[model samples]
Target chain A: MTLDTRTTVRARTATITLTGDVDAASASVLDEAIAAAAVSSPRRLVLDLNAVDYLSSAGLRCLVFAHQRLGRGVEIVLAGAHPDVAETVRLAGFDRVATIEDQVGG
Target chain B: MTAHRLVVDGLGAPSRLVAGFVSALAACAGLPPRQAYRLRLATDEITTNIAVHGYRDRGGPVDLRGRVEPEVVRVCIEDEAPPFDPTGHDPAPRVAAGPTAVLGGYGLFLALRSVDHFAYVHVGGRNRTTLCVLRCAAGG
Candidate 1:
């Protein structure tokens, strides 16, 4: 499966929409997108994971990397994660590092 | 029960194939959606570890075998690389507190937590790792 990432900036919040499986092969794609979004220096970074069907450890690592890179000033929110992905995040204890939401705006 | 073996190059591209293989096994074994997902997650993490860490810099063959029994789904991942015991490694910290918190090392942690039983053995100069997840469990 392929990973497609799109980042849009609105009112100091950069929302990244991701679709496809996030595994060892596709994690770099997400990392690069996160890096590009970080360059914008948004006040908040929101990741939309609703379309992500599979999230491997590599994907979780990328989220941690993003959390560290963005620093404490920028809030990181993982929005609309699939149940499986959300469970993995919870098991990995990543929910403490980033806010997880059932939906981006919900 | 007879185990089905699939040999693939220890590379990231083949992880998708492994996912499909395990998903089919989970369905045949009557695993619930959550349990099946956990099985898939464990399989993916282990295979990815072999591809990225076990066989790093030198590629080799990874043999994946699975069998669906009456009460459990067992999977064995065999690799002809240097012996690395996944079960021996310390799990990554559950919570990453600050910016300096390391990102890597979660692969093995997730792999171990998702399955009910995990074992590693080195025989005949091959590293064999077996993972078992309870079938039909209420919560995986």
Candidate 2:
């Protein structure tokens, strides 16, 4: 699994574009990316999953970490999650916790 | 009882490939898509559990045996590790205030939620978990 993360900060909003498979072996990269995006303490964190093909429990853990670290004011948005990963998030009831969109960008 | 066997090890291209295959087979065999995915996810979680905590990332071979019938799919996963039953295991304490508990045991919870029946037994120092899921359709 390859994880590529790029951050853009505009005003108080931060967007992190992540493209990769987020699974057990690959969650560390997600951890780092979330950490980097959180550094600016942005009010919003948009995670672009347009190219991500999968999400596992480990990946979910990484998201949970992001939620905890960012607190209430932070918005963790998952955009363009692949079918399988989206299904995982749905099945795990993460939709109640995060914002998921069909497309994501600036 | 229709039977099949599977083996898992390291160096596989995709980490969840085996899990997907297992789930796909169940889905094709008439299990509901959700149930099938659940069984496969359960297997993945246990096998991963073995590879992570039991084997400590120095992965070794894990064996899976399945008995599929018209009404149910019974799967037994065996690994060479100290005997442990995830069914009787306790879920890691919830942080409550922080992140959702990512520790462990959630897999077992998911397995229970996905399948109609489930159990685990340790035999000869191997962790053996039996998971049964009902087929949602008839004569499929």
Candidate 3:
């Protein structure tokens, strides 16, 4: 399936709301979005995965790219992850890298 | 136990979501959503590896032969790539996820780890990788 993302940067915080399945084939769309978000050097990067039905390892690799490219100063948060997606992230030992939240903050 | 088969030309996304075919077959085998997702994820990772690494030099045809067994559902992925033992690699990925962390090389680890069992063999000039997922704990 295809993945769609809506990224917005405000007040030095960047949020990328994703939808659809994030399989290997469709993960490149996510990579491009993260690249765009990185341009502004946002202090915090929030990947809202509430609408993501599936997250393959390719999607997780994109998270690694986010972490590695964003540098140590940035705080990367995975917000609103479904149980299955969250479990995969935890299984890959990525929870320690990015803070995972059930919902995006107000 | 009716078997299923699906063939895709390349590991292209959307049009040729190779794992989605396996997922559809797995769903028909009556696996739960979570298990089905894992099955799909495993297949996705393998196919991605084949596309990025194995078949990177040339285009090749990939096939999936799936069958529903009494205890588990199995999908054997067949390709013409060179001999690659997925089990040869360590299951745990070295992911520091830190400031100096170098990412990647998790495809084989994740693919083999997601499924209940996976076996690889080179026979008849084809690389056959079989992935099996348990139907249930106590049997269905």
Write one digit per residue (lDDT tens) for candidate 3, span B1-140. 96988776644542246655776787778888778877877887877777667787365777878899988989898888877778886546455343125456666666877888889898999889998888873432
Give the alpha-carbon lDDT of every model.
0.84, 0.70, 0.80
Off by more than 4 A, model 2: A1-11, A16-21, A48-54, A79-106, B10-14, B27-32, B92-98, B101-105, B137-140
The candidates' interface RMSDs, in order, read 2.6, 4.4, 3.3
Per-residue lDDT value at B99 in model 1: 20
- Tens-digit lDDT track for model 1 on B1-140? 64667888885556688888887787678788888888888888888888878888367899989998878899999999889998888465434453237666788888988888899999999999999888867544
Question: How does each model score on TM-score?
Answer: 0.93, 0.74, 0.91
Give the proportion of true interface contacts each model preserves, from 0 to 1.
0.61, 0.11, 0.43
lDDT of 3 by residue, A1-106 (tens): 5689999999999999999888766888999999999999999999999999888777888988888779978999999998888988887777878898889983
**Model 2 Cα lDDT, one tens digit per residue, B7-96:** 877332224665555755675576666566667666666677777776777777678788778778878878877777776664534422
What candidate 1 gets wrong by more than 4 Å, as runs, is B93-100
Put down candidate 1 lDDT per residue, A1-106, tens digits, no spaces.
7899999999989999999999887888999998999898899999999899889888888887787779877888999998889989888788877899889976
CAPRI tier of model 2: acceptable
How do all the candidates rank in terms of DockQ, highest first?
Answer: 1, 3, 2
Better of 1 and 2 by lDDT: 1
Best model per TM-score = 1
TM-score of chain A of each: 0.96, 0.91, 0.96
Using DockQ as the measure, the top candidate is 1
Report, for all candidates in order, the number of backbone clashes: 0, 0, 0
